[model samples]
Target chain A: MAINLKIENKAVVEKIAKLEEHLHLQALKGFFAEVADMTMFTLRFFKEALKPRYEFKELIKQAYLIGYKSFPLIAITGLIMGLVLTIQSRPTLAEFGAESWLPAMVAVSIVREIGPVITALIFAGKVGSGIGAELASMKVTEQIDAMEVSGINPFKYLVVTRIAAATFMLPVLVIASDAISMYGAYIGVNLKGDVTFHLFFLEVFDKLSFSDVFPALIKTVFFGFAVGLIGCFKGYNADKGTEGVGKSANAAVVYGSLMVFVIDMIAVQVTSLFS
Target chain B: MKKTTGNKVKLGIFVSASVILLITGIYFIGQRQQLFNNTFTISGIFKDINGLEVGNNVRFAGINVGVVEDIQQVTDSTVKVDMVIRDETRKFMKKNAKAIIGSDGLMGNQIVTIIPGPAGKAQVVDNDIIATAKTVSMDEILTKIKVTADNAAIITTDLAAVIDNIHAGKGTIGKLLMDSSMAGTVNDAMVNIKQAAGGLNQNMTAASHNFLLRGYFKKKEKKAQDKADEEKKASEKDKK
Candidate 1:
């Protein structure tokens, strides 16, 4: 009875070990698969972004959809962000009697870091989910497949244009958002103190330079690219039947946001290295 | 087709606006650097730069008229700084104008301040080496403050000793301030001076009445009376 029990115990342990190994391998495989899909999507963008057929009209529609249509939401969020940052930063700076540095401090934060990252996250939430769900539904209904059958390059038509739109539009949005945020910060500064609009802007820009503006603006392009590509990638490879749509949309946002921070970290390090 | 054209127009506008904003920003920054304007170069040699660096503004009478373009250490004590000034400001900057490395505010960045020379002096020519003043570095100021504080400490120590001596009635002033015997002596001296003064006043009155000095006094009095009578006669003649 002892020997039989030992054999059964050994067999159970082996089975459990094997199951653990399989789970680990599956996770590894999924990670690599996602990486491969992202790489492929990036390659497709490079291919279509340069080609002469230029979906110029579609690009415009996407820009309008991405930039103009999203203005009010971005404006509101930007104002709140500026106001809150100013109100919170006041006491800390006031302790040093450096309340005068408020505009410059707020400007740097908005231009260099906060404006891009927050705006991108907001974009991922709104646009990423929209693209993911819209494409997933189209994919489920076999519309993309139908387009392929009709000799349309669905990847170029759908993915590239949207990505291009995002890539171009995001920088514009960030600029507009930064301007609005500074204005908001001005209102915030004037809440307890006095600063003329011109002097406020002067102090803000006095501390700003190409190093702060260019690298920040440059990173937003990658941010837009990541947000648009991840959304499109998830939707492109979404499962059929019924349940995959919600999962794809959720993953798009989560991953898109994750990638923005990752890219931002790398960009900052590289900028610092050069600077 | 019409819809597509409209969309294209919209995109065109968006892209153009962003590009325009960016270009305008670039232009302003460039203008600040004096990239698009006519400019001239001038140099100054200083004993110390006071932490002034390239790209610091050069101010003339508190106006930003140029920027520090270069800085080179010539020796352990001297630094050579170059400035690129607007051509428009060149006429106002004389060869004798002095340059000093200063700060924007108490805690602000360092800038080269150009103190305009006398009005009659000629303008500084291109690449002219202008005079420089030794800029007071933060360390220098702190060192000076330390010296001053040390001197003040010594002075206070000496003063405290002096005050203690005065309180203890050890010196003349101390005796005057704190000694009861010294006060009594001063009172005696005051009484003696008052008596001597009264005696001198009586002696003067007796001398004035004596014959030897009295004729001189009488002659002086007669001259005064004659002058007074002459003045009265002149006044009466004018009235008549």
Candidate 2:
């Protein structure tokens, strides 16, 4: 009986090992499958987007909802970002007796990196989740299905408009955000010491160049596209039921934010190459 | 329909504002680069640029009048810098003006500072090759400082040794300051000089009282009295 029990125990351990291996294999398969699906989805968007019967009205509406409605939050965050960064950086620069470099340094930091990345992340959180949840709920309620049955091109009307709006609007929002941030930085500079508005702007423009502004502006378009694409992809491919809506929204934010950093890293590398 | 049109108008306004801001920013940056302004080009040859790159500001008499447009190595030992100066400031920049590679601040980008020459010289024409002046770089300044510091260190070391010798009563100054025996010797010499002076005074008095020297002394006194009377008469004449 003791011999039998030992054999059974060995069998059980072997079974568990096999199960673990299978689970790992399943996870690997899932990852690759998701990658393939996402690629196909992206290709489909490009195909449908370039076709005739452009969704101009829907595109404008999406731009209004996504870009204009999101401005106040972006503006407030931008102001705080610029102010806090300047305030925190002042002591260190002051230690070096380089407090006068505050405007130029802050301008470069905001225009080159901070302004685009922060704005993209905020856009991802607000608009990415909104797109994801809205589409996901529509999918769950079979509204998307009804639209398809009604002979309407739901993907063209729904996804193309959003992706296009996000692509174009983000650059504009970033420009506005950068401007506000500079103003905030000016305020921060004058908080402890006196720097005239004219001098502050002069210092800012003095350090800035086409290389700094153009690359930053160009990258925002990509950042916007990524956020919108990820959100729409998540929502459109959501699973059945109300729970899918929440999951889609959550995943949209996680993946959208991740893509922003990824794209930023690539953009920096590319910019450095040219510069 | 009305609500949709209103939304479109808001979107249009937002986009327009953003585009305007972007254009304004671009204009300012471009203006700084002398892109929009009427500009004239000038070149200078220098031994070393000291990290002056293209697009660095060119200042004429403390004012940013232009930008460095191009930098090329003419030879191994010389660099050619091209500057795009505003056409408006061309009159102020003379043909004899000298361009020196300077810096914005202690820790700032290198710039080309144009020093105006004698006032009567003609204005600098476009494509004029201006004279370049060699300015002291930070490395050169640091090297001089290092030499000075080394000399200072050596001097201080010698001073410390001299002080040590004074403390030990070795040299003349050291002995004068630190040796008690030398102080005593100096004190004794001073006393001897004082006694000799007193003896000399007595001898002088004795000589003046002698018959042979009395006439001489009397004559000297009379002469002194006559001189005093003459001075008194001159003063009375002056007062009258």
Candidate 3:
């Protein structure tokens, strides 16, 4: 008869525990490594951006593509967002007999938080994924290598132009979105209430100060930069396959959206500290 | 090429519109802060600012004529608030104008109200320190209310004790309110007063008609008749 010792069981449990601890440490290390790589990539891009042989035509084309092309989508989403927010907030405000405060309330919320965050998320979803996938495909098909061989910097041509376009376009998009959203809110207010456009805007502006607007707007620039940089960084360093293209796109969106919130949290804290 | 040019025009219009909107917003907000206007600075040193801050509206009379520009701690007990008043309102503001931190409403922003000084006083100059009146802060109001409420609570406790004594017939008010015997005594006094008043009226009438007083009344009547007769004779001689 063979005697069965439970030696494998004890060792297996210990090994599993050790593996978990190691995985946790590895995860932490990987996170730091990823951050370091992104930072270096961004620094390199900035260095490249400042150098001569600027891609002005490409930058303009990218702006046209990113900012002008994204208008319809941003506009529709903004309108819907404003309308929905108004409809939802009505009952609560009406309960307090502060329906008169609708425009100002909605204005503050949209300008200070909702407009920037929503626009950034949309930009991440649209431009972020586009940059990631486009660049990743270029890498996979060796177009980047061809460009590099032909006395052209792939980073400068693609990353710099795209990032610059995104950074500049996002504010434009936010401004348009904010205006459209306010119009939508005005429509929403008129649905159940009677408020003239001038009065509505007046009330909207009366409560809003510089503190509520500039910092909120300033953070959107960083948000755009983060999204563009992450997208470029992820795509440029993609793994050697079609699967990597998908991974790049996914990571760009995930990371871009995540960075928006993180930056927003920091912005809020800093704004509050000053304000 | 034509299509690209058209797209460029569209982009330009879009960018221009956005910039205009943004600039307009900035201008409005800046205007509220008294940034882009002809303004003069006036300040007030206050024992307490009562939660007044930079950008709080400064009202003259009932209208907003300026905005608070800065708040500085001059001493541990004093705060200096600098206000930028609109240039147009400078003539109306006198040297003796007072600044007081007050609220817009029961539940509204704290505003600095500039009480215009008496007419004929020199106009307020730029950077002139206006007189500051102490504001009753919410905390002080609450404290006073708390003291009042405590006093009211103590008084009510004493009142309740006094009322209890009245109910138990332990004091004068208690006896008057609660003692049936005291009520009976009051009723008996009232009855005795009524009876005494009737007797007094009869005695007064009997005294007025007594023989001892009749001679004096007759003498007064005879003197009245003689004086009337002399007056009639003098009138007849004048008529003759």
Query: Which candidate leads in lDDT?
Result: 2
Pairs with backbone N, CA or C atoms under 3 Å apart (clashes), candidate 1: none
Q: How far off is residue B92 in model 3, in Å? A: 3.1
Q: Identify the leading candidate in terms of TM-score.
A: 2
Candidate 3 chain B weakest ten by summed lDDT = B28-37
User: What is the C-alpha lDDT profile of model 2 across A1-275, one tens digit per residue?
Assistant: 99999999999999999999999999999999999999998999999999999989999999999999999999999999899889999999999999999999999999999999999999999999999999999999999999999998989999989989999999999999999999999999999999999999999999999999999999999999999999999999999999999999999999999999999999999999999
TM-score of 1: 0.78
Show where candidate 1 strays beyond 4 Å. A1-14, B1-7, B74-77, B147-240
Candidate 3 runs further than 4 Å off: A1-5, A14-29, A87-100, B169-240
Better of 2 and 3 by DockQ: 2
Docking class of 3: medium
Q: Write the per-residue lDDT of candidate 1 for residues A5-38, one digit (tens) a residue.
A: 9999999999999999999999999999978878
- CAPRI tier of model 2: medium
- The complex in candidate 1 yields a DockQ of 0.24
| Residue A166, candidate 2: alpha-carbon lDDT | 90
User: What does candidate 2 score in Cα RMSD to the true structure?
Assistant: 3.4
Per residue, candidate 1 scores C-alpha lDDT tens digits across B79-132 of 889999999998888999999888888777899999987889899989999998
Report the Cα lDDT for candidate 3.
Answer: 0.91
